[model samples]
Target chain A: MHLDKEALDAHESRWRAQLINAVAGFKPVNLIGTIDDQGRTNLAIITSVVHLGANPPLLGMVIRPSPKGVERHTLNNILDTGAFSVNAVTEDMVPQAHQTSARYSGETSEFEATGLTPRWIDGRREPFVAESPLQIGLSLLEHLPLKHNGTHFIIGNIDCIDIPDNAVADDGTVDLGALRLVTACGLDTYHSVGSGTRFAYAKPDQPPRPI
Target chain B: MHLDKEALDAHESRWRAQLINAVAGFKPVNLIGTIDDQGRTNLAIITSVVHLGANPPLLGMVIRPSPKGVERHTLNNILDTGAFSVNAVTEDMVPQAHQTSARYSGETSEFEATGLTPRWIDGRREPFVAESPLQIGLSLLEHLPLKHNGTHFIIGNIDCIDIPDNAVADDGTVDLGALRLVTACGLDTYHSVGSGTRFAYAKPDQPPRPI
Candidate 1:
């Protein structure tokens, strides 16, 4: 099947969103934890997280423009407090993680509503999902507005990272398969890690060998 | 173990890169195809692709600053031609896709070197990977540079999209499981999709029901 620009533009907005979102395939799923100035807690499930750079220890995620007149609490809290946490969603926590996307008022705490525990670490203002096997605390470093769309790319510097001892390899690679981190597709689908193959570093004259 | 900013800053750079890249877990992998003004074809495997928005059908990816003084052909080609194509990397193409990351002279064609075919589509300036099950041609919409890290966020508007017939669902969701698309973790590890679960749209006061 072919979907040209004209046909994609002519399709219903809802269908286009679903198609485009799903077409990207599996993405890292994380629950973003933020706190407002008044100490209000906000948690939202986001699948757009991407590693930006390691020297500065930066990570970036896109926050879409709020629909109609609704204000996104997650974006607002991140800006207000300048602190947030990214928690890897696990298989057992998939239900609670997805529930964080529900249309709740800003005053309503998604963490409490979804029955996910919020824990404070390093005395940071934001909370981290306690059930998550891996969690990282970040401070807002740069917030750039993406003009092409009304989205904002939130870049943060990793301040503190917590993980299980068995999940980290000697070379510093995190064993995501052993961590049992869950990935997401489309809007509502969740997937668990399966068979994985690691290839040795590629070279011009050398064929890739399985590590 | 807890790795705070102090510890992270003291670690070796190579360890930091591997750990940070792997901590994101699985990410969508694609082969980016482009051609320079001189008509030299270029292809590189990238995992930073993210769906920005659907209304304008925008996609964004991060192009890190060239290591040392070496140039990145993919970024140079996109800027020169104002066009590029993203092709999903299949399971069997993992080795070839991974090899595209090797440091090759800009004069050398990665397609020929990696044993991948470049197919022109819709009279576009760029060529799509012929082996990919899903391919998209895009025109450069916006080019934003990150000041903090010197990375470039290339935003492109979808001009055309091609996918296999059986992979698309009635709701427009792409069944990655059926497509057999492979995802990447860390820098060299590849993983195929596993068991996936779908849930109904979440609601404010209602518990999420599995679909």
Candidate 2:
């Protein structure tokens, strides 16, 4: 199949969304937990998380603009509180995580609606998903607007991380496959990954070898 | 395991990179292809591609700063030509794709070094990886600097795409697992995903149902 910009623009909105989303391949599926100043919590499944850097432990995610007259709780809460939690969506949490995307009212928390537990650490304002095997607390660093599209690119600085001890290797690599971390492709599909192969550091003169 | 920012900051750089990278979960693995003004092609393995928007078909990727006195070929090529290709990495292409990360001299194209074919479409400046099952051509749209970590966030507008027709479903979702698309975690690990479940659009009053 060949699709040009014109062909893509001509596609039905939902269809185009699915195709475009899948073209990026497997994405990190996470439930972003946030809270408004009124203490009402919000949970939204996000698949756009991208690793930005390691030194400052930065990650970036794209948040679509809220519909006219609608409030995007996740963005608004992050802006209001400067803190949020990214909880890795595992196979067991797929249904609950996917359910969070439903249009719940501002008064209704997705955590409550979907029956997912909200975990709050001491001194933290954001709530984390207790069902998640890996939880990362982050502070909002920058919110850049992409003018081409009204989407906001939110960059966060990792403040802390909670993970199972068995999941982390001595070399510091997290065994995502062993942890059964779920990944998403299109807007609605969720996948489980197999224990992957790790290659040794590539060198100009050597063949790629598994480490 | 729980790691605070202070503890993370105290870890060795490479170890920290691995841990932080893996914490984001599975990532889309692709070979980014670019060409300099002088027609020297460069291919590098990239795992940071994120879907920015669907209508405009925008994708964003992070490029780390080059070492002092070193020219980052891929970043420079994209800037010099305003064109690039993102080719999805598949299970069969993993070894060659990984080999592209080897630090080759400016004149050595990774395509040639790894024996992967560079395919050209008429009028397109960027070369696509022929071995890749999915190929996307993108024109540089924005080059934003991430001030926090000195990384460059390059946003591109999809110009064209070439993919296998059988891989696309009627609903516009691409069957990534069936296509055997490869995903990555940490720095060197590559994974194959299982055919996942696709849930129907969520509704406030309904449980998520597989489509």
Candidate 3:
């Protein structure tokens, strides 16, 4: 199948969304936890997290514009309080994490609606999902508004991280397969990955070989 | 294991890169192809592709700063030509795709060095990986320099796409499992995904159910 820009623009909105989303292949699925100034907590599943840099420990995510007359709690909360939490979505948490996308009122927390436990840390305003094996706390660093689309590209600095002790390798690589972390395609599909192969550093003179 | 910012800053650079890269879970792995004005081709393995929007078909990627005085061909080509291709990395193509990361001199194309064929479309300046099942052509739309880390955040508009006929579902979701696409973690690890479960649209009143 071949699709040009015209063909893509002609596709039904939902269908185009699914196709475009899947074209990027499997994505990192995580539940972003945030809180408003009134102490109202919000949880939303995000799959657009991209690693920006390692030295500064930066990550970027895109947040769409809020629906007409409806406030996007995650974006607003992050702007209100410069902190948020990222919790890796595991296989067991798929249903609850998917359910968090439902349109819950501002008064109702997704944690309360989906029955997921919110883990709070001392001196931190954001909440993390207790069921997640890997949790990260970040503070907003830069928020750039994309004019082409109304989406906001948000960059954050990693403040701290909590991971399972057994999941870390001697070289500092985290064993994602051991944690059963789930990846997503499109807006609704969830995939569990197999134990992967690690390759040695590539050199110009030789073919890549498994480490 | 819990790591605060201070602890993370104290770790070795390579170890920190591995740990920080893995925290986000499985990432979409793609071979980014570009060509310079003089027609020298460059291919690089990229794992930072993120879906920005569906309607305009926008995607964003991060390019790290070049080492010392070495010219990063991929970044320079995209900026010079305003065109690039994203080819989905599959299980069979992992070794060759990984080999593209080897530092080759400007005269040698990665396609030639790794024994991978480059497919060029008429009138398109970028080349797609022939071994890839899903290939996309994009034109540069915006280039924003991230001041925090000196990385470049590049946004592009999808111009065209080529996909396998049998891989697309009725609802427009592409079956990545059928394509045997692979996701990467920690810079060197590659994982094949299982057939994912698609969930029905969530409603606040009920638990999410598989579609």
Candidate 4:
């Protein structure tokens, strides 16, 4: 149906419902804190993920006001450490990545709850997910706050990545199709990106024939 | 790339380059505005467009900081009337949209800029782009202030969408691919999506297999 006024409202409600349901389908990710001494480890499941830029390897996510009351473990930890890892939640690591969202004693580690091993880098205290297809460690760069939503824009500098060799394509582009890129629709439903069809367009300089 | 620290930096930079190059390839979009009572019109080029949420059918973009401080034509117009239209820029309307971005006399009717017509809605008092692949007129639901970026988020409840019959697929999906969707990479580059190469993935309960 055409998206008229009434239809638009229904589409919006449906879309939001799908997003909430689809978060479960998203491959859970480990937001590893990349910090120095005194930095804390905080992990969370990231369903809304996007590629903002490639040159700087910049990616962005909207961090809503967590129930943790301003002292959000992930956001706070990122600010303290100025570094965090966007660990791809694979079919294998979903459980652990999700456990990271649980409410535990501030000192409790999700890594323990999920039984996932943490890989550390020399000279850097931040840990990376051992099972992720790609692990990107980034440094905090800027914040874009959402006043109405009580969300913050947390921009970061990509410092490192841990991508498996087999997932790379022959061409320069990434072969995410082979990796079964998981997509999040809203809250909990998770869906692996299905067969994606592609189409190309010609130049703007060329005019189209009369319809 | 293994995406070590150095590789991460390179990736970010490269993606930035790709984004800028992508937008430069296409025409611009027309960000249409209207002032009622006197029935004045304003239009501008909005290459800095963003898609906020899919579920709620939310749209967001960076509007120029109003010279009169918070008296923004777009934001105020949207807030006052609770409506606005995001008109996609096309080769035919680039000149008008571009000129609308310039310092035009406050009385100038941008709707009159390109000799193009704005299809006015009776109750909403806003207009839609008859030629847009998607012309959505939305009612304001929320407005957020970005303290750090000096930008505001004017989220509207999408009230209507006027899509071409040929652009929609049978399954209720807007087949922009069929219409040759043009996208901006970064600051300037524009590119058409490549041909569809279907890549499939399995469900959660099933063993991971290629579709």
Candidate 5:
């Protein structure tokens, strides 16, 4: 099926949005954990996290515009504390991670409500999901505003990482298949990654070789 | 194993970069197609594409700072023409897609060199990979500078999309497993997605219902 801008605009706004979101295909799912000044923990499912660079070790995620002036608790906490955690949402964490999207009262903590435990570092203000196979601690490096669209691209410097010993292969790549990490499509669908296929580094005239 | 900032800095630079890149896990891989003003087609493998907003149907991709004093062909082309195409790389296209990352001269066409066909839309200068399960045409929306890290986040408005009929579900989500699409880990490993698990819309007090 082919969908042009005009055809896409013809559909209901919600339908178009979902359709557009899904067509981009599978996305890495992460549970973004943060804490407000009052010590309230916030957890939200985020699929926009992507690697930005490696030298200084940076990562970026997109924060959508809040609806009708509603408060985005996660974004607000990340901005206020300048610290956040990116936790890989595995198959087991799917239900809890999805529930984090629901709006709860200011005093209510998503960690407590969803039955996910918050693991805190000694001196850091933010928390990480205890159930995650891979967890990362980051400090806010820069946040760029997309003026054309009312979205913010938040970039952070990686300060720490936690992973299972067996998950790290000889080459340093995480064996996500063994961890059974979940990838998201559209809004609620999740998929598990299977065994990886390693290919030889592509050279000018060489065919691909299996590693 | 846990890696703090000091530990990460202690490793060899190349090893550290590879380890940091892979621990984040699977990433969506795309063949970014662009054309120079001289009508030479260029294709490069990019894993940083993330959904920004669906209302305007925007996508953002990170363009790493060029090496030393080199120019990024894909970034330069997109800036010069204000148009580009994003094509999902499938299992069969991995070799060609990966080769696009190699440094080809300005006079070389990665499309022809890699043996991938470039399918151009009517009146559109940018071309999409003919073998991609999903192809999207986009126009430049905005490019934001990341001065802290020396990177550029290129945001674009999706103008059109092409996908296989069976790949899209009735609810508007794409079935990536059916397409046998590939995801990247680190710089060389690729993985195929397994069956998807769907959940109902999350609510404050309701348990997750399977869709």
Candidate 6:
């Protein structure tokens, strides 16, 4: 059956908590970002993260519709400054990282909310969460607009990466199983990455697999 | 250490992508619309799509950084029509769905790109791809400013969804394992839902695991 925009919008706006909460929970490593506000930095864990494109490297996160109807700090900071950090959360820092979501006054910093130390590098002023084994620095690519409701889709151009040395496999693919990344289910529900049985398939043009 | 915006944007603009790519692959199915000057509908599939929000139901897609930049039909369509569809890619029609990505003329419709049909209801001019097990309509959200060299971010408010009955598990979760969804790895690599072992965890206050 066919669905229209008005119908889909109503279903989405109403069942959102149930829909997103369910699907997002299946993925591994909920995304966390660090935004620089004024001079201090703010941190928030985002399960609403997705990989968009690789060439020229891009990543995206949906900031919930704020009640104020303006823009979320993360979106604004990235736009104002043109950069932000997207870090993967670990099973190790799950509790602490989640705390970044606690509601605080605009002036309050999430770093203080969770007491998670920020890692600093000599050449870069932006900080990566010391606890996260994996992280990346994303340059602001675009601030996309959702004309109907004042929502903006922010695209970041990925530049560098930091992976725990041991997690790297021989093929250059970072073995996520070894990293022990965590995935979020519905609200407040978290799960460890499940066992993965890898099976490869060939194109139809290629001969059928030897079963 | 709180990093400055200049430092953050520069680092994040280039790095961090290596990790997200390590895991999240191309698996999503999107309903892309391209209406020609004649107002005929041209729909296509986008496996590389992401959501931008819940409050406003924002959606995003990473289109190939167009060479001409002006030859964009989707961008122009949204600007003119103010809507599009973020259709979910399911296994039932993965083969036909993937075909929508094949290059087509500016005047041709992706609806015809694959054998799949675009379903439409009354009044709303935009149609949904009938085969998309789970499809949603989105109104024009926003077109973000691309910060660096090239590329843009498109955000849209979800207007509707056509979720199939079989896809939803009893618990209201999408049983991807049962659906056997496929994913895209480096470049052209496609993988199916592999091994899965789910574990449940109780609250911290609960007594330690019975030793």
Better of 1 and 5 by DockQ: 1
- Between prediction 1 and prediction 2, the one with superior lDDT is 2
Ten contiguous residues minimizing lDDT sum, candidate 1 chain A: A64-73
Off by over 4 Å in 5: B68-71
lDDT per residue as tens, model 6, A99-171? 5655555576666667777776665546677777676777777665655655555667666667676765444
Query: Scored by CA lDDT, what does every candidate get?
Result: 0.87, 0.91, 0.91, 0.50, 0.84, 0.55
TM-scores of the models, in the order given: 0.98, 0.98, 0.98, 0.55, 0.97, 0.65
Tens-place lDDT digits, model 1, residues B95-192: 99999887788778999999999998757999999999999999999888888888898999988999997887777877777777887888888988
- lDDT tens digits, residue span B12-72, model 3: 9988999998998789999999999998899999999999988889889988856553547
The fraction of reference A/B contacts recovered in model 6 reads: 0.14
Model 5: DockQ vs. true structure: 0.71
Model 5 CA lDDT for position A70: 49
- Measured as a fraction from 0 to 1, the native contacts recovered by model 1 come to 0.74
Error of 3 at A28 (Å): 0.3
* Stronger candidate by TM-score (3 vs 6): 3
Off by over 4 Å in 2: A69-71, B69-71
What is candidate 2's lDDT per residue for A6-111, written digit by digit as tens? 8888789988888998998899999999999999999999999989888889989989855673549999999999999999998999999999988888999999
Q: What share of the true interface contacts does each candidate keep?
A: 0.74, 0.87, 0.84, 0.13, 0.65, 0.14
The residue-level lDDT of candidate 6 at B24 comes to 44
- Candidate 1: chain B TM-score equals 0.97
* Candidate 4: regions farther than 4 A off: A1-40, A67-71, A205-211, B8-211
Off by over 4 Å in 3: A69-71, B69-71
Candidate 4 C-alpha lDDT tens digits along A1-211: 2467566455445453432222111122334544334544555665434444444455555566554483366666776767777776554554455455456445655555566667776655577776666667677777677554466667666666666667543323344445544433223323333332222221222222211
Two-chain complex of model 2, DockQ on C-alpha atoms against the true structure = 0.86
Which should have the higher TM-score, number 3 or number 4?
3
What's the TM-score of chain B for every model shown? Answer: 0.97, 0.97, 0.97, 0.70, 0.96, 0.71
lDDT of 3 at B17: 91
The order of the candidates by lDDT, greatest first, is 3, 2, 1, 5, 6, 4
